[model samples]
Target chain A: MTLILTALAATVTIVFRFAKQKTAEKLRLGLLALMYSGAALMWTVDGFAAMFAGEPFVELQNPSVVADDAFLGICVLFLGAAIWAVGLIFKKATKKAV
Target chain B: MACFVVPAAEAVVVAIVKKRADKAAKLQAEALACGGANAQTNTEQKARTKTHSGEKISISKKLGWLNAMLWGGTALLFLEHVWHGEVVFWPPFLTAAANPADTAAMLYEIATSGVAMAVLVTLVWAGMAIAADNISWVKAALCKQKEGANQ
Candidate 1:
């Protein structure tokens, strides 16, 4: 499920943030963690709802759906990284202007 | 289905809060500056000014970080829902709006999932603020910025 991957990404980001506080903070690692965690939280709700409805939380039998979710997980990861990068550039530009 | 709406709504509230916080920070800075004007020695005045303005980041700026997180994540989730056909460009916006039964389910999802996500995001932001407040590097950055300002 996308939730699984995004949650993993969030954990890794948080770990790396602690591992290198100075560089990681400059990269806005917390923002990336927030982004992944939001998606993970939503997907977690979806997972629970699915289980309550007598449906599997993840359709392992359906390779296509699994693949789709994996792709989406990667996309979300890249998108979050992109947003953080842009924010960094913008902050730098503003500091220069100031 | 409509889960993204909760965080999206929260983002609007956060933006407004950020605005007010910015104003408050500015006013506080001004008051500090005025108060420091009466300091006895030049060095004392400089120290007072540095300490006042040397905060690593303004409260409003930290709020802006939270806003960015909420808005960015919500926007992406909205697009994902749209891609899955859960959301639409129509009047009610959610595809579940067409059916009474499905609409109730959607409302349940919003109440549970949406509220949870929003709360979790806020909690994470609070944790981030607390962590940054304690981190030595963050303080060093604040001092460096103050040095730059003084120069």
Candidate 2:
């Protein structure tokens, strides 16, 4: 899972780098970023809930490990979404003026 | 490390996108400034409209929808996962519950799968954007070159 996520992150970064020239690309990249991050959050939360509800605490390897991971994931996801939102808003305001 | 990576990567992508936007805007301004005979040409008008329209659609409208869907879906799935405790849906309840390792495995599966999907989507979208931007630039440049040739 970690490997997959990392790969995806790398891919997204590269695409966004090339597409930066067009406003549409920015928005598309933003959207894609939000989607990926959001999905990550979902998986993290779900994983934790499943672990706590069904498995022994020892299975987690460390008690704080899962929670810490989830917390971090959520925070990052939120921040990305926020920035993307702001960009969208700016785009809109600019469009309205034109 | 994962935490740091995600945000840092996002920041970098955002920065690059911003730089591209700046360049495109500058090119546009230059095109406008060169307004003499070229500006009045049909091709010039079309290029101007196309670029602006592309910006409007890509950055403003499409982006808003993408962000909403991506973030909203993420939050919803996360909440559901938390609240429901990894049951996922109903049909597979028997299979889901039958295996003890299923929940953790499933979560892992989702986390990994979601990321992959996100990356794929991002790449495709970015590629399309780059192509469009280039096409516009090329069109404008060709028009200018044509005008020069005529003179």
Q: For candidate 1, write residues B99-141 as lDDT tens digits.
A: 9999998899889888887887888788867665666765555
Q: What is the TM-score of each predicted model, taking all chains together? A: 0.76, 0.32
Best by DockQ: 1
Task: Candidate 1: give the clashing pairs.
Answer: none
Interface RMSD of every candidate?
Answer: 3.2, 10.1
Candidate 2 chain A lDDT trough over 10 residues, lowest sum: A1-10
Residue A69 deviation, candidate 2, in Å? 12
Question: Could you tell me the lDDT of residue A41 within candidate 2?
Answer: 41
Q: Tens digit of lDDT per residue, candidate 2, span B1-151?
A: 0111232244356556656766786787678767767664765677556544443223532333333434444443444344434443465542344566865655455455545444544554465445544676533433333343334
lDDT of each: 0.76, 0.47
| C-alpha DockQ of every model | 0.35, 0.12
